[model samples]
Each structure stands twice: as structure tokens, then as C-alpha cells.
Target: MQPSHRYTRLTAIALGIAGVISFGSAGATGFQIRENSVKNQGRAFAGSATGQDDASVVSNNPAAMVNLDTTTIRTDVTLIDLTAKFKGGGRSGAGTPLTGGNGGDPGDATPVPAMSIVVPLHGAFEKLTLGAQLSAPFGLKTEYDSTWVGRYNAIESEVKTIDLTLSAAVKITDRFSVGAGFVYERAEATLTNAVDFGSGICANPQTRPLCLTPNPTAAAFGPQKNDGLAKVKGDDTGIGWILGFQWKPTDALSIGYSHRSEIDHDLAGNITFTKPGNVAAVFAAGGVTTYNNGPGGAALTTPSTDTVSVTYAFNDQFRMMFDAQQTDWHSLQSVDIKRANGNLITSEKFEWDDTMMYALGAEYDFSDSFTLRGGVAKDESPTNDTHRTPRLPDNDRMLYSVGLTWNANEHLSVDAAYTRITIDSPDVDVVSSSSSTLVGKFKGHADLFGIAAQYKF
Candidate 1:
């Protein structure tokens, strides 16, 4: 027999009852990834607003490109390893028997890559220069076992984003320069979590608080739970801008400042949720045989960033660089997803505060062909204890890094760097969809290794 109209409507409502949230911690605040450029990673990104070594400066301070006279192309890749382990006394606030072990280590390895090109102009353009950069500016992938104690809170989250920048700089005088750029970015996300069938119908906005009473259909799946998967993926192109200024007060000191604007996106996609066969049968009998929904809706605004840096060359062999950056994470207060019907799917309250990051780096030139680099940095987390979730157990971090550069030839150079990051333990106390709560502590550490090659044309 064909599915009834009531059953079809129910299914569609179920599908539209949820939306999406995909985020992970990378640096500064939220899941903003900053490891795309290796040469910058070597110095913990310390003089990034000014420069490190190659055309990649276009990603940070385009004005710095005026100092580079060569037509160059550079590419870099980083292998990042993250280890996050949760350990603590876990209890269910729902006052029910727990399911499985505290989520095991939820961290994994991922690779980030980037490329940029810079060309100096002469004659008509004289002191003006042009450059472009392509890189992953935000990303995250964290997964947990399906049966983990906090599975209902989160099972997995994967997010990917890319930023492309077209930039130009003009040297107004021998001592000063200014630059600006237009940026285009795209982002996609996928997330999953278990369903608490035991608690009643999921608390979707369209339904009454007690929509799923102790009915025959609701009783079919009792006590235990139903496995649910939520997949919401979409792509949107957003526009932003970047501005930078560079100053050379004297020959030995250089100062640079840069600002990157925020981009907002109203992502359009499809949201699908699947349940076990037994639960499906119950839903089918209750006029929810199949799920249906129009385009799903998710929205987010990547934060704006500002950086100031100073580089001092005490002598020809040694140099020091220090940098400070501020991220306006407050712009991202919460993530509330809705379906086409304007019903809520899910909501995340971050109420995040602004963040500040500082870095100090030093470089020593052993010879014209060889150099050594080292740096230390501190990064603050935007999430507070009360709002921290298992999916993003982020905390303040300390970083140490070392690297070296070899000028293989006048036209070629290679750079390699390694960094160790440590974070203070953070407590994870998140409530699940079924109204149960999972509480614990999470500890984490990360390692970053990168290599880059630069060719001067």
C-alpha cells in the first residue's frame, strides 16, 4: 500500500526538525586553522603581519610584499597530530544507567596546505606589487565511539573551509607602504550524535514540550535509545577584505599592522536523520514512515582578526620579532539552526569572549645559505568552563617551535619546522539531546610539523 498523507507529513517534519553545527578548535578562538603557511608556523606566526620569508606574506600583510623584489611562488604543507583524552568522574544527570566508557581519545591527524605567489612591478607600477594566496583558514575533525558515555552529546564533527585572497600593495615612499586585498571564502560541515529515544520525541521546535506522550508508538522504543545520524552539508561563498600597513622608521626596525574582516554565511543544505529499523517501524505506524524537509538552514560568521608586529635586527646575524593578535570571537555568540519551516533543529550557546594571542620569535643566520629559527607563544581559548562541550574541549595553550631554512640556490630555498603544543585540562559538562548530562575533564596536546619550498622566478 502507498504511504498515507499523514505518515508522509510526519516523516517530513522529523527530517526538518534538525539543522547543523560543525566547529573545532585550531588557534586564537573557535576552529580557526592557522597552520597553512609553514614558514610562519616555524616562528609560531610571530611576525606574520610583516613577513617571514616568501610570497606567503600576502596571507597576512600584503604591504610586506613591497619589500620582496623577486617574482616568487611558494607552497607549504603541515602534518598536525592531536591527542585529546577525557578522564574524570562521569555521571548522568538524568539519573539513569550510563551506556559506555568515557569517550576515548577523540583526536586525530590532519594535513593543511597553502600556496601563494608575488610579483613586483616596475616602470608604470614602479614600487607597486601584486600577490595572491589560497589556503584552508578553518577546519576540524573530531570523532568518538558510538557507545561512548557522551555519545549523545557528540559522536563526530568534520568541518572544512578555504580562503582565497587577491591583493596589491603600493610603496608610497621609501619608508612606508600600504596594501589591501579582497577575500573569498567557502565552508562545509558534517556532524553526528546519538538520539535519546528513551527521553521521548526529540525536543524539536515544531512539537509541543510533551508531544510524544506514553503512547503505543512511543512505548515501542523504551528505556534504551535509537541510533541517529545527522548529515548537513552545504557550501556558500562569502566576501571580506584585508588591509595592512608597513613602516621602516630606520634601517634596523620594521613595524607592520594588518586587519582581516569577518564573513557571514547563510548556508543552504539538506539535513537527513536515520533511526534503527525497530524505531522506524514505530514511526511508520505513527504517520512518520518517511522523513521529509525542504532546504535546511545553518548560519555562521567567521571572526575578524587584527595583528601588530615588530621586527628588530640588532646586527646582521641575529633578529627578533614579536607579535600580538586579537580575535573578535564575541561576534559568534551562538549557533542556532532551523529548518525551512522556521522550526529549530538545534542550538549551541557559546557566548564566547574576545581572545588575545602573543608570540616571540628569533632567527639566527649561520651564513648566507643557512638560518635557524625558534619561537614561543601563548593562545587563549574563547570557550568558558560552563559552555565548553565535549566536541570542542578547548583550553589555553602554550606552544614551542623550532625550524631551519636552507638557501639551496639563488632561485630555490627549503624550510622545515616542528612545534609542540600543550593545553591545560578542561572540564566537559554537556547536556545530551535526551536530557541526560555527561560531566568530565579533558586533556589535550598537539604536534605540528611542516615543510615548504620557495622558487624565485
Candidate 2:
């Protein structure tokens, strides 16, 4: 009785709030978006660590800063056309009339931005370089109809993050350079879901009285109108670091390696509960509650990462690139929430696996002023079917892209790129920890377009 009844409405409410503050899955892979640099977006991020064509590499390999010609500044934006939808069977406990319509397309067109700069030091420090950047490395957004079928499981969810970086690098020799950086990051999120006050019946089984919100004498069963609202908001700031090396074994061959440290944050916020007037009357009469005080807190750690890349020029006019990266997503094992007084609210498990991404790309020099880029990649998601939730039903994906760089003059250049993404169908069925049962499959794909301008002085 303890285990089965333990999953009552309380379980669902807790799970929903947990997913909000710790949104681990983004439109990309496992809540991690790689659209940080526009120049790299065009290359499908193939030479992320090894390619030093521009100041953009600062985000992936601080050491690559030495590859810049002089003082350089770059700014870019990526417009994402992404979405996820559920279509299939969804129901309440057998007897309920599976109220609410299937959640329609719950994705939106969002824009991501990034900026970076690199400067070379001469004279006393002739071979040294300095760089800085501001960008968003992780994020997510999903909004369903307030009364969608999965409302009890999840309704609206949004997460946003930004990072500020500072670093320096030294050129040990013409062929070898190493660099490192420090980062300050911040994250915030909002999650909303429906609460089933009717589950109050499970609070104290011995009494066997149906508990809605305000009073039990009103009826033996809970009313659809009795469903209440639950919303949670949390935000935090933390710090991390990145180290990298760029090596040129031969004039035409370059290899780069980089590692990023993990960031830990403790988000402090409050959960707000709203129940129908009648349901409140019932819960008060029974001395029961779906939740204690609204104030809450959660502890979380963003994953660390490693990337290796190589760029080999076949000839003066053509070059090939390859990149492989691994993220320690396994670090996210569970999420625990505590009230203002330190009492436990709930602890939920994520059982995620580490993930990897592989990419291959090529660059062609059409002339001294024009270049073309194309690439493809396979990216894996950390979440599986069983754990996939309404907030984000993520899965493995394939990316195909094309881009071009036009040097209008010695001081100005423009970069443009387009990508088509295919996401493997994932089951969005989360049964064990939600306030309500939600099951279905999401057939999804996305299109990303990016553009950037660079100036050299």
C-alpha cells in the first residue's frame, strides 16, 4: 500500500517541479545546445578545437586564439525552428474520461546569440594571446496548451542560461600553443503542471474518504473542476573552467584537444500552489495537503566535456576536418528538493548515460575572398524512452549543413549557414513519477539558420 499509494498525486507534482529547475534535455542533445558560435555552425562544428580560421574558436579552444591575425571581434545569431508533438493513447485511471485534448506541437521558433573577441600581444609578450566571450551553452523551451491532456504531467516549461568567459594563451613554439579560461554561468527555469487533489484519498487509506481540496463531505469522488495548478521557479549562478591545446604536426595538419570543467549550482526559489475553492475546503477538513510551504531549493551539476579534432589539408585549395566530443551526462543521477526549513520535498532519478558526437566537414577556397563549407554529424541523446518526459522527449539525431564565408574587404566579412536536423522518434511515456500518466511518441525534426559578421583591426 505504501509503494502504490506513494505514487499518488504528490509524486506527479514533485516530478514536474524537478524537471523544471534541472532541465537536462534541450532541443539539441540532452538539454545541451551547440549553436554557440555561428562560424562553427557553418562547419557543423567539425574543427571546433583544431580550426583557427577566426576568433570564434575561443569558445571551444582558448589556445587557438594565437591563430588569429590581429585584434578580431565576432558576433552571431542562430534562429531555431524546432518542435515536439505527442500522438497516441493517453488516459486517466480507467474510469476518468481522459479529459483535455492531445498536446499539439509544443515547440517554438527561438533565437540564440553569441559574441567573442581575441587580441594578440606584441613586444614583451610577442607570442601571447588574450580572449573573451559571452554566449549560451545550454537551454530549453516547451509550452503546451494549459489544459492539454498531459497537463497533470507537464504544461509549460522554459529554461535559459548564459556564460561569460575570460582567458589567455601562450604560443610555446610556431607549431604548438596552449590556453585556458575561466567561466561564470547562470541558469533559470519555470515549470507548471496540474495537481490532482482527488489523490488525497490515498493520504490515509484507513479512513477511505475521498479527499478533493476543501471538504470530503461534498462527494465520494473528486471533480474534474477540482484540479488545481502548481508552478515552480528557480535560478542560480556558478563557475567553471576550460583548458585546450593546438598542435600543428605538419604545415597542413593540425590537431586540437580541449576539456571543460563541470559547474555546480544550488537554485533557490518557491513553488506556488492554487487549488479550487471547494477542493481547498476538503483538504483542510481532512488535515491533508498536496504540498507544504511553497519555498524550495534544488542542487544540480552541469556536465563536463572533452573534445578532440583534426584538420588536414589535402591541397592548397581544399581541407578536411573531423571532430569527436564526449559529455559526462552521467553526472546527473538525481534531483532533490528541500523546503525552506530543510524538510525533504522529493527526490527524483534521471538515470542518464554519457553521450558523444562525431562530425566530418570540408572547406573549399573558391578565391582569395570567398570560401564554402559543408558537413554532417551524428549526435546522441542521454535520455531513453522510459525516462523521456513531456518537458522534452529527446533522442539521437543527425545534422546536415552548408555554409559560406565572404570577405567583403580586409576589415569586414560575413558568414552564413543552414542546417537540417533529424531526430529519432522517442517515446514520451513517463508513468512512475508524474501526477498523471502520459504516453506517446514524438516524430520531430528541426531547421537552423545562422549568420554572423566579423571585423579585424
> Please, what are the lDDT tens digits per residue for candidate 1 over residues 34-67?
8767777888878887784678879689999998
Clashing pairs in 1: 7-287, 11-291, 11-292, 12-292
Compared with the true structure, what per-residue lDDT tens digits does model 2 show for residues 1-457?
Answer: 1212553436333645577533543336887878867667777879989756677677789989988969999998888877667775565542254478777877778788889899999999989999898888887677788878777777788777898988798999999999999999998878887765554443445433453436645655452445677787888999999999999999999999999999998877877877677656655775664454466777878889999999999999899899999999898877786776776767777888999999999999999899999999999988877677777767899999899999999999999999888889888766533345677787888889999998999
TM-score of model 1 vs. true structure: 0.89
lDDT of 1: 0.74
| Number of the top-ranking candidate, with lDDT as the measure | 2
How much lDDT does each candidate structure score?
Answer: 0.74, 0.77
